[model samples]
Every structure is written in structure tokens, then in C-alpha cells.
Target: MILPYPFPLDIQSILNNKNIFRRPPTRFGKMHHTITHPFHTPDQLPMTNQRINHEPVFLLASAPWRESSLWVEVFSRRYGRVALLARSARKRQSELRGVLVPFVPVSASWYGSQELKTLHRAEWIGGWPQPQGRALFSGLYINELMLKLTTREDPIPELYDALEAVMRAVCGENSHTAALRRFEWTLLNRLGFAPDLFHDGNDEAIRAEETYWLTPENAVVPIEEAERFNPRNHGVAVGGNILIQLREGDFTHPESLGQSLKITRLLIDNLLPEGIKSRQVLQQLQQFSFGV
Candidate 1:
């Protein structure tokens, strides 16, 4: 993935910098325990004129803002994507330093009426072990998607759940291509950009025996109709069976997996005009690393 604009902060550099975060504790520590909070729908969260405390969050991206402060982006279950200013976070003993790492679930508190809020507190919650090696890049790729595709303050709880599920799956032993595909599909569906795999442009129910083209405009059309409309850019030719499999979230077949990947890539590229940087890094690693 190639982003239109370079990220202000380099994730690789941050990961390499040993002084950025403190070492993890051996067992349950003051800041490493689970947070208990009353369950509420995202809409129930205070939108204005109040401070939100200990909201469940997953750090998406961060960058240095001003002297001793960090600009943080997080995906909150209650508030969606939020921008925060962590003051004095660069200080060696600042509480926010260790708590702000990516991929871990954290309970964060912030106060402000403006677009960017002020971080008051952050606490790490237990989660699956951090993704390593290729899984790490894949996790970063997922973060880039969240950062690019989601709008700040627009809450989508389902997407948040999907993120956690995909991250856990990606960190496991096997390559999680199916998990990634499912996540991409879920994200697009939540954002209302998912193509109707079960129906064609005319809204007719797709037949399992028919072949169709997934058009650039995100419509499914019968191969014959697509050829008549425009043969040059009728989209990628996919089998009806594969489309059905994708619609049902079943990627058991290699053909379905391949077609799903193509379709998801097209949809994500359509949304992210600048492309994704982490994806480019992943491709590079795969190309150079022997049997990565």
C-alpha cells in the first residue's frame, strides 16, 4: 500500500527505539488489569459538554505534536475514532508512555469539546499476545485501514468488534488471509461500501450457475450483460459460486479466497485513493524474506 501523504511518525522507527516504552510487568500490575464499566451503546456516550473517562479503546496511530506532547488517534468502542493530546507523554516516567502502544486494548479517559481531546488517563487491559513478525505488519495494515477509512467521532461499534476479532485471528499461528478478507468485507459493509455479491446491477438474484463480473462501480453484473455494456473495464471476472461463498463469509475454497481478496482490494483501493503504507511494507518483507 502506498499512502498519498507520508505519516508524520514512522512506526518502524518507533518500534526500533528502545527508550520509547517501559518494559512490561511480569504479572497483573496497577495499570495492566481489566477495567470494569457499565455497558452502554455508543450513542449513550456523552458527545458534548462532558468528559469521558475510562472508555474502552484500541490505539490506532500516534505522532509527536508539540514539546513533550503526543498526538494520539484511537478507536473507541463508545466514541469511534478519537484524536487526543497526551501531554508530557515524552517524559520518561509519564504514565501514558507505556499505556499508549498499539494493538493492546486500553481504557482511556479524555476531556474536551474540541475535535482533539486531552488525555487524562490510560490503562492497559489484557489481550492476546502482540502479533510478531509478519503478523505485526498485518496488524499495522489493519490499523492503517482504521485510521484512513474511519471518520473521527463517527461511531461504528460493529467495526470495533471486528477489529478485535481480526487482530486476534491474525496473531495466531497460521496466516490469516481468511480473517483479513472477512474483516475487509465487514469494514466495507459497516461503512456502506460493500458490493452486493448476491445480486447484479439490475437487482436480480444471482444464480449459482452464472458467471459475473464485479464492476469498478462495485456492482455485480452477468458476464454476458457486462460484455455488452463494456468489455474493457467490466471488472474482475468471478465465478457465481465464489461470489456466493464470499457473501456467506465462507472462504474454504481457494478460488473463493482468491476472488475475495481481489474484490476486497478493489473496494479498499476505491476508498483509500492514496493507498496504504503498511501494506507496501508487508509486500516488501514478503518479497525479500525467504518463505516469509
Candidate 2:
């Protein structure tokens, strides 16, 4: 009969039977005691208890947990956002030290039925370059967006692909702003918060000469109609031409870039009641650079 929870098994017994080298104790002592049962081979454990192995993932964030462990958040191609407990990851010689880094792609394995899974293995898949400078900050902003907007275990493969593409674009010279705008738009669209750029709330096609305001309800209002709309529900004013440009995924125009940034930021802020920490950091960094 299947247990409601994962049955704890001895790591030593499983590893020994598989001839895998035993891990030494961590600095805190007795690290082996915290190591969970191994499922290196599918046949070693019952089919119901088999570990999910080598799933493609991108490390979003990590924090120190117990003495020699880490609490990690990863964006898996197959599993979306996942919370993983990486045992002994903080140890000096642990292989995970270099592997668990943001931006770079890696394959991760885990096993558990609980909300938090136990990380079994991770290996670097190494194709994309690690973003640096402003690009690095941009990458962090995207990570924060993912963490804030996505729920765990909800697979969004399209969003994952967009993230990878945006990261690459951000790393390229002169593409940071455009890449970020596109990514923000893509993310909002995928999450069902995208505003109707081509049409107004009345289902009227947007005219290039007309100005409109993007509403929190993901609708656009003509400026004249917006004046009559509830004052408390007002949105950021955007040019109809810019909205059409954004809908076409073109942010090459200076005005288009600025308007897109303001509009997307407003939408994202509306969704994230607690606000995005990384965005604040990014703004501070921008201010400091201007001051310098």
C-alpha cells in the first residue's frame, strides 16, 4: 500500500548496495545522518517512490538553511518553479557549491511528495553565458518576477523559453531595454494579465492618433472615456501607436520603450501587492550610476 508520505529509507544501505561512494560528514558533523534514501536506479526503490531524475532547470535563488544545507528555488522546464532542500550544499567541498548559481542552466533531480522536495543531484549543462553588469541585474529582476508571479509545480514551458531567450538578449550589447520589455510583455501575456492593446473596452479598434489608458482589468480606455471613468480606477496613459508597436513586439522607438516600461511596471506592481525587491535594487543602482 502507498503511504501518505514518502517512507524514509537508509541512505547508506541504498548507496552501499549500489556501490556509490559514501559522503563524508560535514563541518557540523554527521551530515550523512541527514542524507535521505538514494534512488539512483529506478528498480532500487518501489515505482511509486522513484526519484525524478535530471530534469532541466535554471537556478533562480538559494539561501542558507541548516548548518550544511541550502534552501533553493529553481525554474524547471518541466515543473515550473520548485522549492528544493539541497542537503550539504553549503559544505566547503560539496559539488553543489559551483552548480547552484543563478542564470546558468543545470539539470536537477529531486524526490519527495511534500511541498518542498529533497534535491538528489544537479549537474551543469553549460551553454548560456553568465550575465554581468546591468545584464546581471536584469537577470535578477526576471528571477524576482518569476518568484513573485508563478506558483510552484505549475509548468509554464513557454515562459521558461521566453526567460532563456530574454537572458540571451540581455547579454547582447544594446538589447537590454528591448529584451526586458519583451520579456515583461511575454510574462504578463502568459499569466493572463495582458491588456487589450489593439482594442478599447468598448471593443473599438485603437486608432493611431488616439491616446488611451491601460486599466488594471487588462483593458484600454480612450482618453475622453477615461476622463469620465472612475477616478480611483485610473490607469497609466499610453499612446495608441505605442500600444500597437508593443503588440507587435517592437520597442525600437524611444517613446515606445519608455511607455512600455511604465505600462508593464504598473501592471506588475498591481499584481504584486508586496512589491518586487529586485526592482527596487535595480532602481537604486540606476540612481547611483547617474549620481556617479
- Per-residue CA lDDT of model 2 for 1-292, tens digit only, reads 1011111212223324554323222222212111222223323323233478999887766655657787677888777777778998877788877788777678899998666778989898876666767677777788767765665666789989988878777665555888899999988776666776767888899888988878765368788777776789748887889989988899889999999998888877766655666667677778998995
Worst 10 residues of 2 by lDDT: 1-10
Total backbone clashes of candidate 2, pairs 3 or more residues apart or in separate chains: 0
Residue-pair clashes per candidate, as listed?
A: 3, 0
User: TM-scores across all candidates?
Assistant: 0.80, 0.77
lDDT of 2: 0.70
Model 2, position 201, has a per-residue lDDT of 80
Model 2 misplaced regions, further than 4 Å: 1-50, 286-292
> Over the stretch 1-292, how does candidate 1's per-residue lDDT look in tens digits?
1011134326434434444222222121112211111111223335575699989898887766557777777899878888787888877778776678777788999998666678999888878777887788878888887776676787889989999889879876487999999899887777666677767878899888988878645467788776565555536778888888887889888888898999889867855555678877667667888665
lDDT, candidate 2, at 136: 72
Q: Specify the highest-lDDT model's number.
A: 1
